[model samples]
Target: MGRLKVRLILAFLSLILLPIGVTGSLLQLQSSELEEKERSYRDSMNELESTIKRELTQTSVSDLELNALVNQYAAEINIKDAEGETVFTSYKDPEAAPHNEAIVDSSTLFHVQAEDGRILFVELSSQLPFTDTILRSILISVGSGLIALILLIIGWTWYISRTILSPLKEIYAATEEVKEGNLDYPIQYRRKDEIGKFIRGFNTMRTHLKQSQEKEEQFKEDRKQLIANISHDLRTPLSSIKGYVEGLQDGVAQTDEMQEKYFRVIRQKTDQLDHLIEDLFQFSKLDLRQLPLDQQFVDSRVFFQSLLDDAVEDGKSKNVCIDVPRQIPSVTLSLDPVRITQVMNNLTENAVRYGADSIVISTRIDHDESNFTISVKDNGEGMEKEELTKIFSRFYRAEKSRSRESGGTGLGLAIVKSIIEQHGGSLWADSELNYGSTITFTLPFLKKELV
Candidate 1:
């Protein structure tokens, strides 16, 4: 299974099995050595019996003297005559049997038939030295095995703790760094295991958190720029209104026609102020996702034709000839027509203000089955590539100057982008510095598959 599972399994198995195996091995060694000692002791007893029988039959030695010879074997001697009379005993207590003492395991009984037709009984008993030696060997072997097992347990514990603790320590350190807001630091573990996967997930989380923080900062910056632009833009129109009002009060317009003309200019400036305020409010609503779409089904051909006809009239009236596509593909679209119209109006207004003598509205079907692309192209002073990237950003102007020629409150393109994106479409601009600019956007069709 996993590395952690395997390590734990092995550790527990060793804990259960190692001591049992060591104990069994030492017990078997002790038993084998004891058996060998028993065999040697039995052989020595047989040899001593043969020597005693031969000495009593051939040498005719008395039991007391024979007992003196038994001392050489470190054995106790007991003798009895055929008449059942006690003859001699090497034991300190004449009535005591050697087998009744601690040397019972070493006691051996022998019967001898002498040539004089007499029967004799002899008992020999001694503590075997090999028994004590074997006992000591067993104790030492058991103690050594227990010590070896303890060391093995200690070593195993160290290995298991290191294997588990090291990774845990690394993870803990990484989390502490994240808590301190250092998301840029990365862990360098690359094992293909659970811990590795966990580390990778943590790294991914850190990256996303860092990105979210950056977006928040950028949002704050955009809000600040919006406030600054609004103040500057409102100052211009309010200044004009103040100047015109003061001029009228001071009788600068003496004639009725002049007075009427001054009032008309004031009205025009007031209208401009109203439109600026409305656009700013709309952009804010769109940015905050407060504006919801009221989508309608409209024939693409009719929609484009009507929109183009209005643009052509406005463009011609202003001495700028705008071109409309003669043919538009017959496709039904699901869209918010009011918002799309506002986007086109903003783009067309930009074209006219920026010295475009000719403008064209065109369409292209996207490779996808659901959506079609529309572009507003103008032969205006196009922007640099770097400027193109920031054109759709709120309060960003490539010209870097607040002027009437640059059009509305600098939120027009940004609003257009938000509107198109809200409708599940995309918007972008293509421009060459000296050639021209095209603002393109996608509109989805009414097909159910498109949704």
Candidate 2:
């Protein structure tokens, strides 16, 4: 049996057996007392009978003397002659009165031959110590108490079943549902007891499990898409390179200019392939948390100056003007310089690839002085607001055709977001369709050493 069932059974037994044990003890005590009183009454009656017998033997006992003896003993006396006629009784009218059977059965009797040659029979009454009336009252009291006890046990059993056992059964059924992979099932108990808390906790756990399963399924779908994108991207460049090599072997490019153009196209395709592979490698490291950050405190102004110089140099080829704030914040920033440089490079390259003519880099410190914010705004054909949220997701390209033409692997912003977050920072973008876009990020400020 279950522990609770066993406990309830033991409790019921205690309720029943305890009262019975006590009642038995009380009844035994009352019985002993009753026996003692009966024995004493019998002894007194025997003494009275013996005295009367002796007195009759010594001298002829007068009726008045017998009456006096009966009065002294507080008993009833009956005296009969030898022929059983004309007996003297303590009752005033012996023929009109009948003796009680219980009193007669408990009475003492003796015979004595009188001096007149007649046998005298005398009987003395004995008072019973325990009566039928008292016995009946005791039985009624014990019976009522037992009935009340039974009612109490019944109510207790019902309470246990409703509050404890019922909920436990529901929990068991819920577990069975969970074992069958049904996470949507929930317990419907509403009380605020421990059992209710447990039920609520179970429901919460099921909800989390459901969410996790959904995320896992989504991740699987994203992985499939990633594989498809990688295959398509890899095949395009390899096919171009293979076509160019075959053309050279077949002498399809007869002139020097045509062969030079074919070789240049092949090198460009190879470069695209190299860039795609490098992005894949970087994204894989970031996703797996294998990319380590060499975080250090660096002066913000010096870092931005170097970053802007590199961006300006790279933007010159695309005719993109790289603009920066004349005054950079003089705070010390905590970041990985190499990773932050990669972030800037990716952002500026995205701007140049997306028809940006001018790229502006701005910096500001938060009012609380806890962190620094930087924004890279560009005059490019911006994206819709809906695309902003998904730009940081791997393999998510807002403009697939434009991305292919620009040789974009779609992991640039994703990598940048990862690097920023790993440095205890956040990144977001604000863009308006047909307008310009601004990509903003934050980095924590290095704490000042106490003097």
Measured by TM-score, the strongest candidate is 1
Error of 2 at 238 (Å): 1.7
Per-model CA lDDT versus the true structure: 0.77, 0.81
- Candidate 1: regions farther than 4 A off: 1-7, 14-164, 186-205, 402-407, 446-451
Best-performing candidate as measured by lDDT:
2
TM-score, cand. 2 vs. native: 0.64
Which digits, one per residue and each the tens of the lDDT, describe model 1 over residues 322-427? 8876587667788888988888888888776666888888886765556778888998888888888898887777675634423367777888888899888898
lDDT of 2 by residue, 1-451 (tens): 5555566787788678866865666566667766786778677778888887777777765534776566555577888887886467774334333344233346677788766667988777745534663585468557755875787688778878887889999999989998898988888988776777888999999899989988888778868977987888888889989999999999999999999999999999989998899898997797688988998888988898888887888788778899886688777887899999999999988887888899899988785757788999998999998899999988888788888766788889999999999989999999987788999999888657211
Residue 414: error of model 2 in Å?
2.5
Clashes of each: 0, 0
Report the lDDT of model 1 for residue 393.
83
The Cα error of candidate 1 at residue 318, in Å, is: 2.7
Clashing pairs in 1: none
